[model samples]
Target: MSIPPGESAPNVSTGELNARYDKFVVDLLGVIAYGELSAFERLSSDARYSPTLHDRAALGRMAVTEFEHFDVVRARLAEMNMDVELAMRPFQPSIDSFHDRTRPADWYESLMKAYVVDAISGDFYRAISEFLDQKTREVINAVQTNDESGALLQDRLKKMLADDPRLASRLALWGRRLVGEALTQAQRVGTEHSFLRGLMIEDELPAARNEVSTLLAQLTKNHSRRMSQLGLTA
Candidate 1:
């Protein structure tokens, strides 16, 4: 794909560029693609939990978006002379574990999990891409990485939490459960892929770890505030 002038392309000849691209870009894209592919499968199944036609359609749309993301990553992998499935193979178990462990019980829970996924992935990708060459960065940016479904979910969930205060407790508890599952999968991935796990985001290994920890802390705080704001017991 043609990127605009000045876009950073992968300079494979430059060892530093190649290292950054491989460590951060590859990892981020692979994870993004893996997540989308799994979401495509799981969200299709999860849509059944929607209690209304609109809610069902909303969930269905998320699946569609996930497929689009999968296509984007698949194409990128091809351009890099990598087989998408082979590249994704190593990550499958971790991704599968995450979705399997956090099977949503209801419409709200589904939305809550979606929100968490969106926020965390966005935070990670946006940080990881900063060090890439212009071409590589542009290509990554060109892909649809934003969590639009999460926005829709947030709007719906916020209103629901407002209407039914008790739902705040239920949803916050549900959010924690989803995050816990994701952490479990993350730990599994890190343990399994020592080299990949050491790759830093924002050019700092310590910072990335801090970002992950800090983000989790923030999510927890947000959940608590949301629960309290809705007058629900946490």
Candidate 2:
């Protein structure tokens, strides 16, 4: 409950005194947890796009890993004495909208989401993971990382382009849109959150304003190189 007119309770328990610490833990983790859930749904639904048994199994395995992360978040919330549903509710719309509006049409597109979109998300999450406390750090580390899929993503992008040169241009455009949408979503949250805005600024120095731009530029260049290997436009 909120503090009474003349009386006050601390913003967090004495045990949880770091306001920014607690905020980062709750905000960043909740977002990551929601992503796990969405990934599960997207992969399960989109696996049908795959033409081969091996591709379908790979996507299913990725979805299963995402659900595993979801389970970790569920248990972590209970330990924190917070309601998981309450922590998760406000995020449903935004997360749902992000995945919904970017549905992939084929197997390649699905892997692209798993690769490009998920990699950028990992970059963002890793940024906030540093601010958390010990237990929080352990939890963050325990949560899933996409190293396997990430490696495969790079390999597959090269092979796809080598096999069909014309596929490169279309995939390049698709990658650009995917990155752009993710940045727009990020910009939406950054403007709406003072703590995150401050933290991002703190993370960058003389070029704080250009930090995200630079990161995106790097992502685009990497994406473009991958495209070129496929004989696609940057």
Candidate 3:
């Protein structure tokens, strides 16, 4: 249950709020660390599908960077006195299921998955970072701000689409499907984790609902913009 609106809710103490915030930070870090680890694995696997040696090497580099990001978050979790693996375990199923359902069929689809799907997740993390403490916020900002992979993916995808305009329709459909699966994965995570849910809501039901709606809208808009960047319809 959520915190009820106005007088209907019990008064919450400073201690309670601090504890809640601490749990939220730990939960957030855990999920991010797991996500990076998963990305590293996926990108490493995806590299084998690369058409050229240069592309394979580029993906290998990106995968290494992903592992580096995972280590950063893992260290933060350690500092919080949290068991890193235990903290990340709860999120594994939902994230794994998302990837299983949306596994790409080819190199082009893989590129779209890497670019569109990962960017939306990054956007979500950036949005949530607004509500976290300074140190936690800094950690998230540092890891999420990686531009080399994004730039590389964008350049390659744009050129691919330009070279074969016929691919646009298929890739656009793939992008839409990926976003749908991603949202389902996110919903499952939020439902299972009350502390994460608490971070997204307010003390009032209506306001909280509105906040969530606004956040989804913003995410969708950003996704559409990303699709347009690749010359695809969202």
lDDT value, residue 65 of candidate 2: 85
Q: Candidates' TM-scores?
A: 0.73, 0.77, 0.91
Q: Predictions ranked by TM-score, top down?
A: 3, 2, 1
In TM-score terms, which candidate is top? Answer: 3
Q: How would you encode candidate 3's per-residue C-alpha lDDT over 1-234 as one tens digit per residue?
A: 333212132476555656666777777888899899999998999999999999999999989988999989988998989988988998898888888999999999998899987798898888877766678878898777378889899999998988899998899999999988877676667657763455433455466556566777888899999888877899
Cα displacement (angstroms), candidate 1, residue 52, comes to 1.7
Clashes in predicted model 2: 1
Query: Residue 26's C-alpha lDDT in candidate 1?
Result: 61
Whole-model Cα lDDT per candidate?
0.64, 0.66, 0.81
The segments of candidate 2 whose C-alpha lies over 4 angstroms from its true place after superposition are 1-17, 195-234
TM-score of 2: 0.77
Q: Quote the positional error of residue 189 for candidate 1 in Å.
A: 2.9
Residue-level lDDT tens digits of model 1 in 154-230: 67877887778778767777766765665555556655664233333234556655655665566556555544544
- Clashing pairs in model 3? none
Each model's number of backbone clashes?
A: 7, 1, 0
Model 2: residue 92 alpha-carbon error in angstroms? 1.3
